[model samples]
Target chain A: MRLDQIRPGHVFLLVLILGATLWYLLDTLDTSRRLTNTILVVPLAILVFAAGAFELIREILRARADPTTLEQRDVDEDQDSDQTPVDMLRGVVLLGFTGLLVFFYPRLGFDLAVFLFIFASLVMLEPRGYLAKAAFAAIFTLIVLGGARIILPYPMPTLIL
Target chain B: MLDTTAFSGALALLGSDINIWLVIIPGLMIGLVAGSIAGVSNTMAMAICLPLTLYMDFLPAIMFLTAIFTGGGFGGAVTSILMGIPGTTSSVATTFDGYPMARKGLHNEALGVALMASVVGVLIGYVILLLVVAPLGAWVIRLGPAEMLLIALWGMSMIAALGGNSLARGLIAGAFGLLLGTVGMNTAGHIRGTADIPFLLDGIPLIPAMMGMFAASQLFTLIGSGYLIKDKTARRADYGKVLSGFFQVLRYPVFQLRGTLIGVFVGAIPGVGSSVGNLIAYAQAKRTDRDSESYGKGNPKGVMAAESANSSSEGGSMVTMLALGLPGGGGTAMLLAAFAMHNVTGGPSFIDQNMDIVYTIILGNFAQAVLLLFVGLGFLAIAGNIVKVPITWLIPSVMVLALIGAFAVTGDQAGPITLFFFAGLGWLMKRYDYPVAACVVGLLLGRMVESELIRTWQISGGGELEFFLNRPVALVFAALLVLSLLQPAITNYLRARRARQQD
Candidate 1:
C-alpha cells in the first residue's frame, strides 16, 4: 500500500501485533518451559504477526489492482464515530463514569457506588428533575440490592448493601 | 451402557426430581433476561449466575446451569431481531436477516421465527445426543491425543470462514486471541505473562473480557443511534405476529434439519461451538436455497437456519462436556468447572455409573426447550421494548450492569479492570472491521489447542508415523476439517462460473 493509503487502523493493528509479540518473547525469556505449554506461546505470537504482515502486504497488490478500493474502504472504517457533538459528549461522559465506578466501588462500598452511578446515569441520560432522578435511583438501588440481599450471601462486603 | 433400562431409569430420575424441575424455569428466565440485554452475553450470564448455583445440590446445580445454557441459546435472537446489536456473538448471524425483517415491519414475525427455530433446534439436538452419547463417548475414548489435536486444528480452520470477508484479518484476530489466552501460568506452574501482577496468574478473566467484547464495545457503537429500531412502532409486541412467526419454522423442516445437524456436529467438537455453526449453517442454507439472493434481506428461512443451528449448539456443546469432559465454548467450560466444584466428573466411567444423572440433565433440557416457547415469547414482548430506550440511558445503565456483574465474577477489582481494558480493545476491533469473533474463538480454544498439542507431542515420542496410524476417527475428522475450509471457496467459485455462463 502507498504511504497515504496506510490508515490509522492498519497502524493500530500493527502496533497491537508488535506489542503481543514483544510481550510473548520477553515473558518467555524470563520464564522457563517445564512440563507446560509455555513452549507454544512465542510460536503462537510469531504465527499471528506473520499472518498480519502477510495481510498488509497482500493489501499492496489489491491496491494496485483496484486503486480506489483500499482508500474508500479505509475511509469508511475510519468513520466509525457518527455521533453528533452532543451525542458524542454523552458517550464520553458515560465512559468517564464507568472508569470512576470501577475505581471507586471498592473504596465507596458497592451500594453507595452503584446508587451514585445509577442516579448520575438517570440525570445525564434524560432531562429528569433532581427529585425524579433521586427517586428513580433510589428505587433502582433498593430493588437491585434488596434482591441481592435475599438471594446472595449476606454480610456483603465493606458495608455493602 | 445406554440400554432401554438405563433410558427409562433416567426418565424416572427426571420425573422424581421436583427440585431439578423447579430450577429449570428460573434458570431459563435468568438466561432469557440476561441474553436479551445488550452487552450481557449468555456466557457472561452463566458466569454471573455461577455463584447462585453454590447453594443448590449437585444434580440441581448442574441441571440449573444447563437450563440457563439452553435458555440462553435462544434468548440472544430476540435482541438480534428486534435490535441491530447481537446480544451475544452466537446470535450475530441472526442480526443479518433478523434485523432487516424487523426494520421492514416484520419484527414480530422474525422473533417468532427465531423462537420456533430455536425450540426445534434444541429438541432435535437432544434427540441426536441421546442416540449418540454412549457410542460417541466410547469412540472419543479411542480418539487419543492425536485425534484431539486434529479437532482443535479443525476449530482453528473454521476461523478463516469467521473473518467475515477477509481470511487474513480473521487469522490475525484468532492469533491474538490465542496469545492472550495463554497469558496465565503454564501447566508447569510457571507464570508466562503475569507482568508481576498476582491476579494475572490466571491470565485475563475470560468472562469479563467477553462482556467487554460482546456488550461494552457494541454499546459504544450504539451511542450514536437514536433508537435500536428506526420504525419505532415495531418495538411493541404483537402477539399475533409472534405466533405466526413461531409456526413459520414448521413450514421449513428442511432448514431446521440441516441447521440442527450442523449445530450438533460442530458444537460437539471441543473449542468450536454455535458461533461457527450458525455462520456455516446460514451460509449453506443461502447457498442451497432457491431464493438465495433474498437471504440477508429479511428472509424467514435465513432466520430459521441461523437460529436453529445456534440453539442446537447447546445440545452439541453438552455432548462433549458430559461425554468427554471437553468444553465446546465458554458456557460449557463453566459447566465443567461446576462439575469440579460439585465433586462430580463426567467422562466414560462417570456416565456409565451415573447414567440416570446423565439422563436427567438431558431430559431436563428437553423440558426447558418446551418451556422456552412460552417464557421466551413473554420475554421478547417485554425486552423487545429495549429498542425504545435511548442510547444515552442504555449505554451507562448497561455499563453499570456489566461492572457489577464483572465484580460479582471475581469478587474483586480485576474483573472490572479487565472489563475496561477489553472494552477499548473490542471497540477498536469493531471499528476497524476486524472480526472480534475470531479473537474470541482464539481465546476460547487457545489453551485447549496448546495442551492437546503438548500431549500429542509427548505421546508421539518422535514416532510420528506410528502414532498417526490406526486412527480412523482422526482421519475422518481431518478430512472434515480440510473440507470445511475449502467448501466456501468451492461454493463461491461455482457461483461465479454460473454467472459467467449466464452472461
Candidate 2:
C-alpha cells in the first residue's frame, strides 16, 4: 500500500508523539517527588496524544473512502512548495546551528562562533553570490555586536580577537 | 502659570539640547522603518533600541524611547497600505481599507490619510495626558487587585469580539494560552511546568514568548509559503491627491473623534495597551459607521479610524502608567521596569515629588508626536523606495536583523534559536488551520487572566464560581463576555433579516 493510503505518516506521527508524551509524563511524575505541584505535563501529553489519535483515525477513514485522495499533489502551489522536505531540512539545519551555538557559546567564544554560524546559515539559506553573502554577514555581525553587545544587561562573551 | 512655565521650560530644553533631537530623529526613523516592514514590530524595534537608552540621562532617554513609540505607532500603516500585511497589531485595522486602496492604486492617498489621522490621534491622546494624569493616577491607585482582574478580563474579551469568522476557534486558542500560563510557577510557591529546565523557573520569558507567538510565527509562515514577494516599481503618485487626502480626514471627524475616544478609554486601562485598543476602536468604528459595508475594501475612513485610535490610545495608556504606576502596554511596562531599576515609583505621589521631570516626559509626548509626523511622511516616501529593493537582498537582511534583535534581547543564542523554532511552530500552526493570532492573543492575555483569577479565588477562599458571581464589576464583565461571545451569532441573524428585507 502507498504510505499515505495506509496512513503510515499519521500512524508514525501519532506513535512518536505518544512516546514523547509518555516520556514527558513519566519524567514529570519522577520529578514531582521533590516538588508539590499540579501535574501539568501529564494533562498536556494526554491531550496531545488524544488529538493525534483523533487525527490519525480521521486520516484513515478518508484514505479508506477514497484512496486516491491520499496521494501527494504537485508542488507548484506557493503554499505547498515551502512544506517540502527541502525547506524542512533547511529549518532543521538552521535550528541545529542555533542549538550548537546555544550549547557551546562559552567554550568557542561568542563573537567568532556566532558570526561563523550566521555566515554559514546565510550561505545555506541562499547559496550563489559569495561576495553579497559575505557583505550581509559582516554588516549583520557588526549591528548585533554594536546594538545588543553594547547595551544589554548581561556581559558579552569574551572576544578572542 | 504652571502650564506656561512647563511649556516654556520644556521648549527651552528642546532648543538647547541638539543631542536630544539627534537621538529622537534616529529613534523616529527606526520606528518608521519597523512599522513599514510587515513582520517587524514596533515593540521589537523599541526593545532592540532600549539598551541604547541606558547610557543617556533620563530626559534624553525617555525622549528617544517615546519618539520610537510615536514613530512606530504611525509607521505600521505604511506596510498595511503597500502590502496586505500589517506591521503591528495596531495596523491590523488599517488593512481593512488601506490594502484595498493600494490595490485600487490610491496607495499614496491611503498613506496620507493614515499619517494625518495618526497625528490627530497623538494630539488628542497627549492632551488627555496633559489634563488627567494626576487625578486618574490617584483614582486608580485605590483600586485593589480585584478591580485589576476585571480590567484584564475586559481586555481578553476583545479577542472574541475581534476574532472575526472563527470566533469559537479563537476562544479555544485563547483558553489554551491561558492554560499554558498556568504551567509555570504560581504566586502560591507551587511549580507546575519546570520540567528540569531551571531557565523557566522565573516563568516563561514573557517577551521571548510574545516574540515567538507573533514575530517568529509570522516569519516561519512566510518562509513556508515560499511565495516570493515580488517587488513592484510603480511610479510615485501626484502630490496634489496626497495633500487633499490629508484634509479628507477632517470631513470624517465623527470617525476620527469616535476612534480617538475608544483608543483613549481602552488605553487608560492598566495592562491593555495600544494593540488591543486599536482592535477595539477599529471594531467600534466599523460597527457604528454608515458605510459599514465598505469596510475592509480600501475605504479611507477605515484607515483613518484605526490609525487615529491606535495613535490616540498611547496618550491614555501613558496616563495610567504615570498616574497609577500601572502600565497600559508592553513598552510602558518595560518603561515601568526601567523606572523600578532606578527606584522611582509612578503615580500621584511621584508627580508631586518630581513634577518637573514628569512634566518633561509628558511634554516629550508632544515633541515626539510632531517629530513623528515629519518622520512618517518622509519615510512613507522613502519606504516606498525601500520596498522596491530586491527580495534577495531584503529578505536575508530582515532575517539577519530579526536574528540580531532576538539575540540582543537575551545576549544568548537562545533568543535566536527560540526565534527560529517559534517561527517554524508558527508556520505549522498556520498550515494546520490553527488560529495563530488567537494563540498570540491567548499568550498575551494569559498571565493577566490567570493571575487575576488566582487572586480572586484566594480572596474568596478557593471559591472561583462564587467569586465571579458575587462581585458587581466581575458580574458585569462576565455578562459582557457572554454578550461578546454571542455577538457573531447575533450579527449573523441580523444579516439574514437584512437579506430577507432586501429580497
Candidate 3:
C-alpha cells in the first residue's frame, strides 16, 4: 500500500487504542498479579490490541488492492463532503476556543469565561452580526449564570454576577 | 394477583388525600426541567428535592418523588430528540433516531412520538407492576452474577450492530471504551490507569464523558452547517404534527409492547436501569424490524422502541424498590432514601403489610402518566423551538452549557477536562467511521461486566464452565446471546434461499 492512501487520523487512532490498551493491561498486571484483577482486563485488552492490529493491516491491504475504497470510506453524506480548508480551519478554531474556555473557566470565573467564549465563537462563526452576537452572548451568559447560582448547591467562582 | 383488600384501601387512601394529587404536576415539572438539562440528572433533582418531602405525609412524599421519576423519564427524551445530546443516560438511544429525525426536519413528530410512547410505556409498566410486582420482585432477586454478566454481554453485543459498515472499527471502539471504563480502581483495590489523578479513583465521570462524545463531537462536526435542519419551512413546531406523531406510535403496538417489556425486566435489575433497557430495546427493534436499515437514519419506530423501554423502566425499577427495597438505579436509590426518611422499609414484608400503600403508589403513578400527556405537551411546545435557532449560535451555547454541566456533575475541573478530552476522541472516532455509541455502551457496561465476571469466578471457585452449566438462567441468556449474534446471518440466508426459490 502506498503511504498516501493511509489516512493519518485512522492510523493515529488505531495506534492510540493499541498503545492505551497495552499500557492499561500492563498497569493492571503490575498492580496485582492476581487472577481476579487481571481476569477481565487481560483478555479484553489483548483482544482490543489484536483487533486494532488487524484493522490497521486490513486497511493497508485494502488500500493496496483498492485506493477508491479508502476514499469512499471518508465521504459521508451527512458530514459535508465539500469541507474546504477554511471550514477545516473554523473547526480547529472552535475546538481550540473550547479548550481555552475550559482552561480559563475556573480562573476567569464561569460567567466571564462563558460570555467571552460565546461572543468570540459567534463573531468567528457569523461575520456580520457582531453587535447582535455580543448582546445575545451577554444576555445568555447572565441568564444561565443566574440559573446556575440558584440551582447549583455549591458556589462557583465568578468575576461578575 | 390483585389484593382485594389492598385495592379498596388504596382507593380510599388516594381519595382521602388531595395533597397527594396536588404534588404530581409540580414534581413532573421539576423532573422535566431537570431531565432536559444536559448535566442535571433525575437523581440530582430528586436529591435536591428530598428534603422538601420530609415535611409532607408519606404517600404525598412518595407520590411527589415518583412524579419526578415519571416526568424525568420523558423529559430526557426532549433533549435527545431535539439535540443530539441525551438529557440523561436513559435517553441515549433516543438520540440515535430522534436526532436524525430532527436533522431531517421531523423534530415535532419525533418529540410527539417520544411523549406518547413514554406515556404509554409508563401506563403499561404500572399496569404490570400492579399485577405482578410481588412475583416479579421475587424473580429479579434470583438473578445471580452469571445472569448479570450475560446481560452486560448482551448490551455489549449492540456494538456490532452500531459498527456502521465496519465490524472491526466498531469492536475496536467498543474495546477501547471498555478499557477506558476500567481506568479507575478495580474491585480488588488495585488502580490501573488513573495516572495518579485522585478523581480517577471512582472512574471516569460518565455524564461528562457522554456529553462530550455525543453532544460536543456532533457540534464540532456541524461547524459548517447553517442550521440543524436545512429546510426553514420544516423547522416550525406544529401541534398538528406532534399529535400526528403521538398517534403514529399506535401503529407500532407490537414494537411498543416489546420495548416496554424489555424496559421493565431490564430496569428491574439493580444498577442496570433505563439506560441498558433503551439500548436493549433499540437493538431488538433494529434486529427484528423489516426496515432495520433505516433505524439510525430516522425511523420513528426506533424512537418509539427506545422511549417505550426507557419510560417503562421506571415501572420496572419501582417493582424492585417497592418489593425488595433495592434501588434499581440512582433515581430509585433516592426513592429508597425517601422511604428511610418516612421510616418505611420496603421488602416482602412491606409489600405484605402495606399492600395498600404499594397499590396507592402504583395507582398514583398511573395518574402521573396520564397527567404527563398534557403537561409534557406544553413542555414540548417550548422545547420544540430549539430547531429554529441558527446552528452557529446553538453550537457554542450548547458547548458552554455542556461544559458547565460537566462542571456541575463532578463539582470540579475534572468534569470539563474529561469532556474536552472525550470530545476530541469522539470527533476522531466519528471522522474515522467508528460508532461512538458502541464505545459509550462499552464504557457504561465495562465495570459492571468486570465485577460480575469476578463474582462469577469466585462463586464457581474458578470452575466457570461448570458453574455456568449449573445456572439455567445463565444458560438461557447464553443461548439468547448466541441467537442475537447470529440473527442477521440467519435472516440473510433465509432471504437468499427464498430469492433463489422464486427464481
Model 3 earns a TM-score of 0.95
lDDT of 1 by residue, B386-458 (tens): 6677665666666766665566566678888888777767766766677776787677667667777777777
What lDDT score is found at residue B172 in candidate 1?
75
Cα lDDT tens digits, model 2, B145-242, are 57666666655664554443434334444445544555556555565555666656665554444444444334333433322232243436545656
**lDDT for each residue of candidate 3 in B439-472, tens digit (9 for 90 to 100):** 9988887888888888888898885588888889
Better of 1 and 3 by DockQ: 3
Candidate topping TM-score: 3
TM-score of chain B of each: 0.77, 0.74, 0.97
Off by over 4 Å in 2: A5-54, A67-126, A151-153, A158-161, B1-65, B72-117, B142-147, B154-176, B213-228, B234-262, B275-310, B325-346, B349-364, B382-386, B464-472, B488-503
Which residue pairs overlap in candidate 2's backbone? B96-B296, B97-B298, B137-B323, B216-B423, B273-B328
Estimate how well candidate 3 is docked, as a DockQ score: 0.66
CAPRI grade, predicted model 2: incorrect
Please give the range of 10 consecutive residues that has the lowest summed lDDT in model 3 chain B.
B215-224
lDDT of 1: 0.74
Kindly report which residue pairs in candidate 3 clash with one another. Answer: none
lDDT for each of the candidates?
A: 0.74, 0.64, 0.88
Fraction of native A-B contacts kept, per candidate: 0.61, 0.14, 0.73
lDDT for position B233 in model 2: 35
Stretch of 10 with least lDDT, candidate 2 chain B: B224-233
